[model samples]
Target: MKEMILMTPGPTMVPEEVKKVAGAQPLHHRTEEFYELFSNLNKNLKEIFKTKNEVITLTSSGTGGMEAVIANLFSTGDKVLVASIGYFGERFYDIAKAYGLDAELQDFGWGNAVDPNVLEDKLRNGNYKALLVTHNETSTGVTNNVKEIAKIADRYGVAVIVDAVSSLGGIPLEMDEWGIDAVITCSQKCLMSPPGLSFVALSERAWKMAETSNLPKYYFNLKKAREGVLKPNPDTPATPAVSTIMAVAKATNMLLEFGLDNVYKRQATYGKRVREYVKSLGLELLPEEDIASDLITAIKVPEKYKASEIINHMKEKHGVLITGGQGPLKGKIIRIGHMGYVTEEMLTKTLEALKDAIKE
Candidate 1:
């Protein structure tokens, strides 16, 4: 039997150990055993988020975390400055609008990172109650300088909400030290786990925002979630995805055991190797070198070639599944993912397959 390699940005390859947990018999969310698992998961989540604040787990995809941030941290008519560079950053703008918030977007080019100087100017001049940004723009393979942006936002006394969906465990971010108010991530990207769980962490300032936010929400209500989790037993506000939570528990343990710094180093090294190998094939990168993400690499397709040609050929002929570009980039580029359980051997094979596919 041949193995299928996932080279997409997410719903990334899961580890066998984590898969084993997800495949196990389901447990009731109310049980003592489940509480213990949930507790340990939250503890590890705080470490992964690099925050001392309580990390909340929701039984939804990464978007749920982003939505939760908007739902709980700001009221309707309250203004937010969305620093948008790519698809996911645009998503932040969309989310804000969906909630009836006054969202002013600072649009950078799709293939570039957000300029901190530009962000600083906006924060200093705008009357925004919050600054929303994506830590990693998965669509463009660009990573923003959240630490610097947070510093600038902090100086302006604006709350910083970050979408760390694809970068959290694979990249380095310090939520507490950098004064990030809200951070969002998911199980499928860098956690080496299957999809269906999203994590949200809030700083003290963010919690304070939640206290006054009047945005209408139910399942994604962060205040309700905090109330439940802050209890002595600590539980989710809703009936949790028991199996997925168990799987994430195993995955987070594995990441911690590997050491967070070492895990980040591995992902960065793999990302660099992918970039170098793709460039050697005369492929150009979408993002600037300084802003390129350490979890995924977006390569521009040659003028005469279609991204689907290489992507479909690799999947059909070699069982290597990489993804094509999104939104405006569809058919113009291909993205190679190096996060989670992706290995060097798999990347080498993927590169070889891509090379052959391109020649065809």
Candidate 2:
């Protein structure tokens, strides 16, 4: 098989140390040894999120963590104002309705940020139980205006749940400073590790609601996770992702060693480089320049060509890998992730391959 370089937004090129750690042997969840791992995991997760709150680690991917947040913090008929900007945002609404929540979706066009004025107006109505939104809408490579949304949610006394799945470490996230009640993320994406580990940074307010929200919950319950994660022994309600946790420890430590400021700067700079390169290629960008995500850049495919054709050419001919758009934007956009192990060389090579592939 041809060795490939993964440039997709998710399951990004994992670091060598991360892959090494992921190969470590598993352990029993109830043991003190495991608890020790869990303790460190929670501590560093807090550091990465730039929060004082404890983080709940789930055995599943980011979706499981999102679902747990919905189940434990919201109940049937509870009014929720959700911001829909991309594929993941739609899933938030889907979860809300599936669990019987009164979901009022406020939509922004794909690749566009939600209007803060509109959110403020909606919150002024003062009728929501919670305000749920994604910090970085992964599907569209657009980062939402989370701080503004948090301010709006606070004015209404509605609990705020943010899906930081792609923004946590790659971006500077001040959960408490922004007044975010619940911010959930995944190990994949900008964390620069493999999937199967989903984390939630919780405010005291979020936990209070989780304790008495009367929502049915089990394995992924935040309160239960808090108990296990806080103890000296690290364990989950289900079997923990031992390898993933080990990989996370390395990944987080690497982030700190590199210094978060540097990491975030690199993310921003790398993305800007790609965006500039894409534009020079005569292609349009999807998200507004100021609102684009540092984790990935979504470039509009030309009308004369198919996005998949270019993607296949890059993969088969140039050994480069990127992603096509999801949902309505499919076949019209190509996503290039500059996060994780991505280097300037990779972007340059990928761009060269893209140029070659698009040559008529």
Candidate achieving the largest TM-score: 1
Q: Write model 2 residue lDDT over 1-360, tens digit each, in one string.
A: 976888887888888888888887766667777677667767788888878878888878888989989998876788998988999899999998989999998998898898998888898895898888988876788998888888888888988899988888888789989999888899988788899888888888887777777778878677877776665455676778787887887888888888889988988888888889888888999998999988888989989999999999999998999999999999989988777777777878888988898884
lDDT of each: 0.89, 0.85
Q: Write the per-residue lDDT of candidate 1 for residues 53-126, one digit (tens) a residue.
A: 88989989999889988999889899999999989988889999999999998999889988878888889899
List ranges where model 2 is wrong by over 4 Å: none
In model 1, what are the clashing residue pairs, if there are any?
A: none
Give the runs in model 1 whose Cα sits over 4 Å from its true position. Answer: none
Q: Can you list the residue pairs that collide in candidate 2?
A: 34-234, 35-232, 35-233, 35-234
Q: Which ten residues in a row have the lowest lDDT in candidate 1?
A: 223-232
